[model samples]
Target chain A: MGNADSLLQAEGLSRDYEHYNAVQDYQLTLKRGEILGLLGPNGAGKSTTLRMLSGTLAPSRGAISIKGIDLLQQPRRAKQSLGYLPDQPPLYFDLTVEEYLGYCGRLRGIRKADVEPAIQRVIKTCSLEEVQKRLISHLSLGYQQRVGIAQAIIHEPDLVILDEPTKGLDPIQINAIRDLIRNLAEQHAVILSTHILSEVEAVCNRVQIINQGQIVHESQLGIQEPDKVFFQLHLARPPETAQIEALQGVESVIAQDKGRYLISVENAQAGLQIVTSAIIQNNWGLLGLCPQHESLEQTFMQKVFQEDRP
Target chain B: MIGLITRFEYRRLFLSPLAWTLIAGLQFILALLFLVFLENFITELQPRLALIDDAPGATDTVITPMLIWAGILWLAVIPLLTMRSFSEERLYQRQALLMSSPISISEIVMGKYLGLLLFLATALSPTLLTAVSLSTGTQLDWGKLIAGFMGLYLMLASFSAAGLFLSTLSRQPAMAAALSYGLLALLFVFYITGKTQGSESVLFIYLSHFGHFLNLSSGLVYSSDILYFLLFSTGFIILTIQRLDSDRRNG
Candidate 1:
């Protein structure tokens, strides 16, 4: 069931080839104004999941509702509310950028009278004004990719599904595309798949890390609150590990070479006060104290490698 | 939706030089054939026409053979024209644009098919015009000419449909073209084999598209021939739609 703001709802989604399952029981609920990033390794079914959600690939078993319209039962209506950009930009190299966008507008059921305005709107949005008259094949990879995005958003659909929108771009181009994607998400619910962790961190509001055809972890970006805090403690004279672990609120203390200790604590403020006061009371010098933040890369690696272990 | 796709496909075809080159080459060859047929009709057949009552006129002596040559030429040309209909899209992974759109599979297939037909018609226009130009100098058998044109068009439609279906079966455009050429040639073989066995080999003759096409080209308008082309084209078009639908499912 989808709520009013829910733009996409997929449940029990799975796809399989004859010999192996590609995606298994994938589920997602995307709300308006949210950028949901699908992060996975190569061959991890990120594209397959995006394809199924976009109505381009039928799931062997699943249900998908785009804007509350059943994709399987009423695909025409459901697909009208969403636009998709596959891994490769579905561009016809023979057509000029403007002509291709017009064709895409018409294909998306935009009225003949409104097609020009729609083309202008996406061309402007995608920053394709200068090359609008040039053939797509003549443009660089970045512009061709922008044209791909232009087609996807031409009809101003409520949802946009893109598979690896920033796959083969340079850093500057990737940033530009990310900005364009951010602009799109302001009015459309965006779901993009990528193997780049920083891409998810930079542009997505939430992320799902998939591995071996299953979602291993899902979390809201920038809001993950770990139960324990970690700190790298450097000291002129470090206390024994048992003495530090005996302190209240200090979870674990592992000694390192040259008087450094990796410390985990139950609470940041209280645990820091307790540990520092104990060190001062014991005459152990505190050379430096720094908090270590856990990055998404760590989580990704942990989830993916953890799943691969027998 | 179908109209939009058809227009796009048709324009896309013209944007490429392949279609233009094919059209020009076909016209040039047909023009040479037309001149040869006309020269024979004038220098060899015209003098004898007065002695034979109701002998075949320029329509049979010139236009019929010219149209027959055009038909055979198109048997090769149609595959080249229709080979990229679906195969190139799949090869480039551009079918996602249509597959993800709100349009149905049948609409996509029909739109591409009709677009190829539109191109075929354009390619055949000069030949048709040359045939029609004969009316200015001689009394043309309009009935036979019309029947021949209709038969050629029907045969081409069948060829294009089969070509389009084969295009869906493979991502390689060349492979699709070769497969379509082979399939059409097999039907021609059926006609040849059936002819050697005489009309008594009703099954092969009936199954051969060339036999039915020949009937129409000879100014015979049998419903059976019309039904055959219709069934052949429709069957292939439906198979194309089903193939695309299965691709979505199986992908």
Candidate 2:
């Protein structure tokens, strides 16, 4: 969705804590306007990775570059194009929304003359106009989260890193923040860590699931994998497992209910005719037949709990 | 970037009532001490004038005591004011906001130090009023008063720098404040040890800050004394910067 030049490129990023490696050999390349979802379980080093990317925590080894500028060597120059929000919104409780945003803009090297206009732009974009004059301590959790995002974008950074952007919020607030994040991606490349699978599906263009400090899976959205598709069938008289297993392109069969079974197919379109024909010819009295696409939950569980795999 | 951080910190200091309360409460105590010293000076003035050709004037007797009271007040007040400088941000997990910005750690430390210095300057301004008001009726030694205030400023700057360094060491604001006060007290009491250990021990005399401040408070503006304060405060500020830089590597 962007040009050939990626906005963020991190290679071989790793952090060691004397006893174990928190994050190991991490790699990422994000283009402009791409929403990359970082999916991981607890103790998966997601926050540690984000912290290293943001320059808050130094990596034990490896290198990160933002817009082709080395993060470690030219941090000040590289940070100009980066904005990061940690897991908790870092707000100065005594300052109002406008005051805090203004401070953030100038701290990021925004010109004094341009700070006000930039703050106004983010206030409008984050829908924080009403609470612009209210102290952050007085605002609700949702508005505080909005203010957090507003500070990140106040400098108009090209790469925005958010660690658990929607960690705590009601359903409506989460939806609002999700929409705001999607809107942010129109101008900035966003990388957010979240536990909400639905949120990733709704807003992310690409997802990378990490387990045990490694990227276990990565895929782009809207492209279905037919090879992994399976079918669920209910019948009055089900056939033997060996009979279904003998059919061409069928991987396995498992009995589910009194007369139901889940059939794993190598290819959904090609295996459909063979499995249905066998069931009908056997007089199994097929009552229901439907494709069951694998959900991200299954993929996440499989990736996290598979002990033998790295 | 340093200026931006300084302004933000100043705003925070302005909003917190703790700063105002400390300043106001100290001013009240100094004023009360001023009256007591003035009454004692007035009662013994005539006897001293009759006995000696040049008696100690109001600046020597009254202003000096008031300045000493100001010093004592600051020994306690500076720590209270600077307790939340870097420690509070760390405690609240907001250090990332400043550390991750383009601004360097030295700039952050300088900005915080300057912000607290400005607040201390303003908070202690009223104590100078007590010294200046003596000009209306009695002779005031302007040079001595200036030197005394200069000493107070230097002492307060060193205290603030030390407090700032201690703040960087701990995440709890109260612990920072207590440690700073305890350290300052330890330094203050070294004067007694310096006397007992004799004049040959340069380390005890120099480390305490007692002799240097005394020289300045007595209107003796020796370059050596000024240099001592300058280097002392700079040492603490440098220590603070070093600690903050290490956090980047350690975190």
Candidate 3:
């Protein structure tokens, strides 16, 4: 009841299964029109938290509220506000895409008058027009994913929680899902939990990294640079061993086999000019100079290992 | 809201070849068993009545409306109809979708149990038609026969609910079916053994499923039997709801 304004809120949520803590001391908030990316490795409790928020699960010790409706008490009301896409899509293989969406819409409490339009909107929005009449079992993995998203939005819920929505998708399918999610954010809040860090950057506005049942770090997209960069120097000839060490703020330079050196630097600007100029002045033919910002993968590793240290 | 959801569930179940085969096959097998029982009952009745001399005026009240075979056939079919009610959903991950929906636990549990019960009753219609056809052969105690049918309905309803409660406890369909079979076997064997020894030997016989089947089998309309079966069905349904709720909360 205290969290009526937020689209979804888990305050001090925790769940234990057979005496083992699945998710401990977890807190997340999804406001309207926002997409929150929950990132974590396998067994890190990403799915557990998503289950709790979706009302498929209830926390052992916490409050999950949707627009101020307490899920533990008024579950039906809270559930009406949530649309969840689990890692495995809960689709009936025998039903066609259109029939599946129609069933889902009704289950979510959509009025009879709106069932048709709701299904149509999601079909078009998810680009499921081609396979709308095909049986779910016959569709490819990518199209199945689209059907999952379509069902999640059929009732136009306030919060759409997609867990591994792009899992097992090809590059083209991944692009389609990314676009679909971006479009979904316009009408409802979205939270997509994934181990693929790049997915968060592409579609989500904010991200939280969880490890071993707890959130370790959270950052908003485009808020700040990733704080470190790598300069991959392609040289016609290997530079002097001390040359990389002499540069300001250069952490280390390791030979990456066959005349390439992975030069780690404190930031992008400091290493960019220094490495390029150093190559030219030293008469080392510079085949290429590439900058590597902290990709989501690296940040994931950084957080995971940092938390592991005693 | 629950009806609409359950109707959709029925449509889905109808499309599954596994579901169709079971429902259709049960009907086919029951028809065969009914014919065999009718022939055997008539044959045995003739010999037993011969000892009464030439008095054809004797009332065949007990032997005409033979429903023991019909009742036995129903016991075998109802549990199969309901054994996968919740187990298959969990196996395929569809239960998660249902649990997360804007429906109460009671609605979901009752909807599934009724859905299976409806399918089972549809299969029983032919058997009822056969009973009507047999009425031409002799005078039937129609009032008692109807009472027996009512008892069969409630008895199957109770068995189906017990199966459904077991289904919700496990994700494996075979395990769920085995569990219901195990419980049924205990009631059939132990109840008979105890009744033969002494009624007081096993007071638990009062709760045995077959004990409830007896009132209907013998064409005796006892309000206590009706109330017992109704309570049995309702009690297990409540158990199923709580089990699902626990699964949801524990996750």
Tens-place lDDT per residue, model 3, B173-197, is 8888888888788768767776785
TM-score of chain B of 1: 0.97
State the lDDT of candidate 1 residue by residue for A254-305, as single tens digits: 8999999999999988999999998899988989899887778999999999
How does each model score on lDDT? 0.90, 0.85, 0.79
lDDT of 2 at A283: 89
Better of 2 and 3 by TM-score: 2
User: Model 1 chain A — which ten-residue stretch has the worst lDDT?
Assistant: A219-228
Question: Per-residue lDDT tens digits of candidate 2, residues B152-245?
Answer: 8898888788999999889999999999989987887777677773454667778887788877888889998888888878999999999887
What are the models' TM-scores? 0.92, 0.89, 0.84
TM-score of 2: 0.89
The regions of model 3 sitting more than 4 angstroms off are A1-5, A223-293, B36-66, B135-138, B198-202
Between which residue pairs do clashes occur in model 3? A4-A67, A4-A68
- What is each candidate's DockQ, to 2 decimals? 0.74, 0.61, 0.55
lDDT of 3 by residue, A60-150 (tens): 8888888888888888888898888888888888999999999889889998899999999889888899999999999998888888878
Rank the candidate models, highest TM-score first. Answer: 1, 2, 3
Error of 2 at A3 (Å): 9.6
